[model samples]
Target: MALAFDEYGRPFIILKEQERKSRLRGLDAQKANIAAGRAVARILRTSLGPKGMDKMLQSPDGDVIISTFSFFLSFSLANDGATILEQMDVDNQIAKLMVELSRSQDYEIGDGTTGVVVMAGSLLEQAEKLLERGIHPLRVAEGYEVASRIAFDHLEKISQKFEFGPDNIEPLVQTCMTTLSSKIVNRCKRALAEIAVKAVLAVADLERKDVNLDLIKVEGKVGGKLEDTELIYGIAVDKDMSHPQMPKRIEDAKIAILTCPFEPPKPKTKHKVDIDTVEKFQTLREQERKYFDDMVQKCKDVGATLVICQWGFDDEANHLLMHRNLPAVRWVGGVELELIAIATGGRIVPRFQELSPEKLGKAGIVREKSFGTTKDRMLYIEQCANSRAVTIFIRGGNKMMIEETKRSLHDALCVARNLIRNNSIVYGGGSAEISCSVAVEAAADRHPGVEQYAIRSFAEALDAIPLALAENSGLPPIDTLTAVKAQQIKENNPFCGIDCNDVGTNDMKEQNVFETLIGKQQQILLATQVVKMILKIDDVISPSEY
Candidate 1:
């Protein structure tokens, strides 16, 4: 009935019940989009500084996420659709933008998701005020571009280069502590920082000037206190032995990494042979058992006390291994196998025929430890040869605490890794922001056009970071910002950032607060670019209705 015949016998279709809706090209669109961006920024602002608060988000199905991540806040609040296929409202569009911004920020740099978002939101908020005062959007964009160059130059000028070694890790450790201050693990920051520094240094590739984070595994268990966490010098396999009679612990173990399975090989084509006599059947069964026994004998001939296989082991092979007093761990994942190969200075043999005495790995000891009331066990392969791979065992009182601790530890570890890669740092607690703001304002004064207003707006946006810090620390934001500016102007100390300590004064360097300059620089660049893009947008189009 939706199709009808025309005069020339041609068919045409009509959508009888359709209705179109559209909104485009006006101040209303700008207002809605800016409002959404501001709303998202407001959510992340309270979680900015060391004294920031956490967000407890509960999903519709009762799942809860306790985090301070800006992307998580944006996802839970603005774009709360059931699925990605749903149409986005104008506000949801802005939320999606922030979500993508934070995702990209996290992937590119491990920290500063909240800081960048809050900064971008502040810029857009300032741009809104300029637009209401009749400043052209293009002029504002031009001004932002100029100010960004000055800010970046100031950043490089202020950053101090660092070195990483046993005696030189104090600065890196302090940076990790600053990164962890806002997280839930601040109570154990000192210990956690030590662990992070050691873990990164252990895996650092001196020639490449990089650390392979994959080599450092983070394993979590819920039972003990958070301070009980320890680092394993080698990889930990989540599985135990393949047979009950196998030795539970093997000291001075020679291990084998096998990618091939233990079961008998299959014929490419389907074929069968029937034996009428019982003696013939018994002979066939004996041949199968001897085949598995021969495989175990090859492992023994190579002096392998422990066997880790990528594929599942046969029961007959397991029995043969148990008989030979060899402990076999079957069904190990490929990733674990690679880590094991790295840890023990061994190679993964893809075929049974390729395994030799030289192919076997060496470990000081291989043991299994049980945890929890149910007695779940994990294999600890420790004291490996030239082992760059290590494991961090995180323990906590409950599931939520463990999750939060892991997140905090990851942030701290990322900062440690960042320093090892670059080693150049700037003072945190808003020291860099205040100094950059002052420099930007000076640069703005030299500009001769309306762009000067936009450059000044950029300077004010930079000030918002320190103001957010003071507000989150429960200090009077306006008064504290005023005092901080006056101190920087009087003493010419770029290190004059808000101090949340005893007097709630301004001195980041004295407080030992610092962060990697790369993250902060990235935040400024990304936030400014996003704000410029948002400012240039004067129209909204929903093409779905058309």
Candidate 2:
């Protein structure tokens, strides 16, 4: 476009405000993209093994987050995508894939997030070397695809059944422990793993191929030790009683889960009611009180010993219920009310007029436990009738620790759920990766040429997992890898993996280390696809073009 003339007849340039920033093209762009990926991988490299350290992230909002590097990376990427506030990197294909893999892995199997990111980064890093040797990206991608299929098949062959019989919870607990190994929850792995395993199993609906995670409520209080975390048979609400005079404990409690509020209903639209006389005002007060009284009476008539309200309970209703020797919890919300109904075999009555004995729920005990003071109390409704819902009470020393522990427990629970759903797992400690890598290389030899070279590169990329584990565990990566490879090759034991904590051993199975076969398969599929996508990207358009 040509320059435009202003009203004063002075010629002026017509262009966007030029912003100055560094630009890269061709080799520089590829290098920057790969470096960005490696940078993410490096952030998580140190937090890989059982002896891994935690990452402490402090945001600009003064919120502190203490979690594993995978969680931090996943969260950061999510925020970046949502806000789009960071400097735009049109060529950072690897970064985009890192986020995609982290999120999808997390959603699919809830573990192996770090492994996915690291392996994807390592694959691209390897591809960079292959590219230098004149191998095309298309050939690399094809080889990766072939190698991924073989790896999946190998994973299936090596996976073992994860049973949950009447007496054996070892496999399930071990799976939970593996998921928690690189997390802060490793500090209380045994106890927390047990809690996680039991929590998932308690609510697992295997016949339906579903595990209702919402049924397992995790309630955190910041005053006790991590060891204090325990699973309750029923729900716990972090709310105090509606009335001070109400009984704090009620055994053999007949519970009522109310959706309607025990108060005067407001007009749906704008309206005016004139109280022209004091007698009219008095009548209004009496009508509201009587309405609340009738509501409380209806609850009592339905054999309700405790009333849990989804909405507000007026002062008149509280006083009436308290005088009637009833324990009432108000403002319980819709979710808890639904959970309570599920736990106690109760039906939710939409209106107070519909109250009946059949709609009332039963609990063994309804008790209020005061934590710090009256203002900080939790209601524990324990021993519900044939309850499938349960609660895990999490206790920690501080806010950050509590949140981190919750995250770790969530991952543990998800892994347990995976085992319950699939009941198949592969040897951990990099055994699966090493075995798959070996198989991929053998398959690569069947197809000679540039494709074979790319296949070999993919095989080499699989070694990065164990290498990372060894490096993070303070062991020599080459030495450990050599020993593991020798054991697997000579003894023909796919279970041979580096026992990093033990220093010089290669028995991950005997050490009770395992990874969900589904998770590993997902990691491979995602990592390879991401690497292939990045390898095929030979051009990087400037952000301004959009």
Candidate 3:
């Protein structure tokens, strides 16, 4: 029978026959996987730093979610394009699994999601080349591994030793922020770092224990200049309650007084009472009075001087005290209360206090004004607190800009978190799919039990990181792979950005230099492996087939 053809008149029969051939091919899977990896990597490339752009994705339900790099990668796979890959019978499970692994790795490492994807693509490309060169997959994998180790060593040497103290933190943050883009992302990173440091310091006294808020202090509005107030004997609430009559100046005042807006007796309930319930009860006048008296007596026992109760004050809480002699002031917003508490230098929860210059992280706040007469003013409240209060403020001329900026900020934050917390993991931006391809390449090499292909596959996988970085740095994947090979041949450093000039030629580290080269080499290898997986998608089949 004559062979059938598709619209392009290609041999459909041969294609179908080839499809049925379960035996492994040299480069097909590698190419397809790499393409997929690169696609994902490209999507996130722009979302790098604070200057990075935001991606807005509209879901099938017409819900729009603003996205950063991490979100974009995740949503992209989960929502839209993933089904296409699955239907292609491209080992949907493996592809999804690998992409997830990449995302997790990126989360851990912070900055390399895009790099991972790009390098995976490159790896697949190189795998094809190696196969053509008559190099077995096993040998390639071995070579790639050797190269990756060297790259990693170089990375360690280049990474500055950063101390996690206040003095050293800023400089380290600055170094991390030193990127090609000149955007607020750097500042955001610094701010986040600072917040992290503060959290660390605040909790240093209570390591290996749950965070305690009791040590944190609360202040009253009347406590002028925290240092001036003395410990008062009773809680006081009074209207027209002025500062101490005898003490003309804050320095003259001897007592720390807390004034509130409510009546003399603050309500205390055996059970937690809702605010509305407290407001509704009319018969509890005596109960309220007793509450004040008890509080005052408690203060007096502690040697407090004056407890004044200011009842039904509009702006402040009414002071409740047992004794009549204590002096306390009351105002609105709990500002005075907070100030006095903080000024006392009492151990208090860190969040309640106003953010101070010293308390701010390495990145400072960036302010912008409202544009186009919008009533909503923009405030950028970026800070880097460890698990506490790091926030990104977005201000722009339009709603779109504000939203986009927020997305970018989120992406930057995620990247920074990953980078700071887990520096060891490898990330493939959108290239996780490429990592899948690299795995397939390994499988292909070992198909029908080719031991050599397996070793080569391992080597190629190792070099994924450097290749990804190079691609991110705008280097061509093929050239980078060739360079790695050349370096291996010459026994030179297979890594990029390594300074070997300091060591003497006779030095043992230099004698092998492979260890030094492995870091960069591994990066490239890992990246290429992913890239290859992303690129090749020629065959489309049902999910069950894979």
Candidate 4:
């Protein structure tokens, strides 16, 4: 230890063992941070576009996730940007930032998670060159901010409004198909996209153009092929009747949604109850049976044909319920209960006193549907009074496929929702990026300062996306991008992008590949912001984490 004096002349003690700590400042710090972030972005780069690769990550628990993600969820097939980053266990703070960048994009835009991280990594790579050329890091960041604005504005100019209504849903379905094309479920992208779009529209309010995703439950079962996936007009739950002898179908049913328990309420605190004689025991048993009977009688009194309970009951109560002609489904999850209430326009009763005829939910038909075996059965609630709540019942060969399909459909659903909120759209296949790159590069000449160089670098970074797409698709990255850029300028057509699928034309419009305008703009703005943050970090200190 050593003593030191501050500016005020006060003495202080200093401890040794500084060897465990490390610090990087200025150029060294910036380079290290850039390298960490760039490494992460590079991992997701190949996962971009339709031909992009999927990442298969294994968790510590040995659960393998394969995502073409584009890995918020660990499935068998995926390489999605967000999914990969979320599953990747990283120590570097900058790398974690890149992960957050992807997550935020997924949360907000629901698509382009990989592309944003890839773009950020490209920008960082370019900024590293600028730093070596003696340009100020902040100056490079400022240039990026300027370039991002230009790209954002350019996206708006190139975007077109897509009109769709109840009578016209093909456009929305096509937009969602573009999203699913790069997913593991792309084999059935058309069917999945239709299901996604219809599910969104069912839960959406066209007048307000707003949708509450909660109302649309995504239900999946591992059994049939992906083609068996269907959208239900009502809620479908993985539950069956509480009893075997209970009728499987209830027509024009009156459902009593209950949160209260079926058995008599137990004491909250510890208590002693000793039976000294057989008569006392008999009286106590009779009292308990009375409680169960009263609860059942209350439902019958309220004219409830079906009872859906949030909590489970004992076999005694189940037997009594079945004998009393009340078909009760016990242990229904809270979410399914709320959906049931909404679908049937019923109220959830917490107490027997609150039970009334008006509180009962009305449904045209409630049936127990069995799949391959009677053991594999689900309760299908349909033709409700409200009927606004819906479910996308997905079936797959295995658990992994079902999980991967959920993530893919999630993106598709979000895309359809975004369009409903705002009908503006842009072409995909990296065409939009190429268009913005040409615009940003041309605008760079208008700047007179060193920011001009940074601006031009930003334009070059923009080419990384189309390049990556072309490369992943087995085409020459530079050649494909060059031809597309040339075509955009020659034909004055901004819709030209990398034809990853080798579909005759390079025009995304002709390919019918559509992406939301807000999503693309958000991607550019987010990538630039993250890169700028990384460039401005001139100091990184790691304290001994013991």
Best by TM-score: 4
Query: How good is model 4 by TM-score?
Result: 0.95
TM-score per prediction, in order, is 0.90, 0.89, 0.42, 0.95
lDDT of 3: 0.36
Query: In candidate 2, what are the lDDT values of residues 1-546, reduced to their tens digit?
Result: 337899999998653334212445555666677777877777666677786655666555555554443223223312111112122232456676677767788788777777888898898888788777767778878988888888899899988885575367888898888877766667789888999888887887868757889999888998878888889999999887888777899998888888876677778999999989999999998998887777777778878988888887656667777787878888886888888898888888788788899888889988899876657889999999957999999987876577677778878888988888788999899999999999888899788767888888889999999998888887899998988898899999999987877845587878888888898999999888887777667666566743
lDDT of 4: 0.90
| Reference-based lDDT, each prediction | 0.80, 0.79, 0.36, 0.90
For model 3 the local lDDT of residue 398 reads: 41
The number of the candidate with the highest lDDT is: 4
Decide which is better by lDDT, 3 or 4.
4
Superposition-based RMSD of candidate 3 using all C-alpha atoms, in angstroms: 14.5
Clashing pairs in 2: none
Winner of 2 and 3 under TM-score: 2
Q: Give the TM-score of candidate 3.
A: 0.42
Runs with alpha carbons beyond 4 Å of true place in candidate 3:
1-42, 45-56, 63-91, 128-147, 157-165, 168-170, 179-285, 288-546
Off by over 4 Å in 4: 1-22, 56-58, 61-75
lDDT of 2: 0.79
Report clashes for each candidate as comma-separated counts: 0, 0, 143, 22
lDDT of 3 by residue, 1-546 (tens): 237779897764433454457433445554454445445545544443223455566555555655432222223312111222222223343355346535543444333344444445445555656666665555555555544444444344433333344355453233333321223333343453343333333423333423322222211222112122221211111223333232211221223233333335335766675546654565465566675565545544544342222223322223232125544433423432332333232221223122222321221222222334433222221221222322222333344333333333333333333333433322112122223323344444444534345334544554454444445445565675455445433554322221112232322222222111122233355553443333333454554433
lDDT of 3 at 182: 22
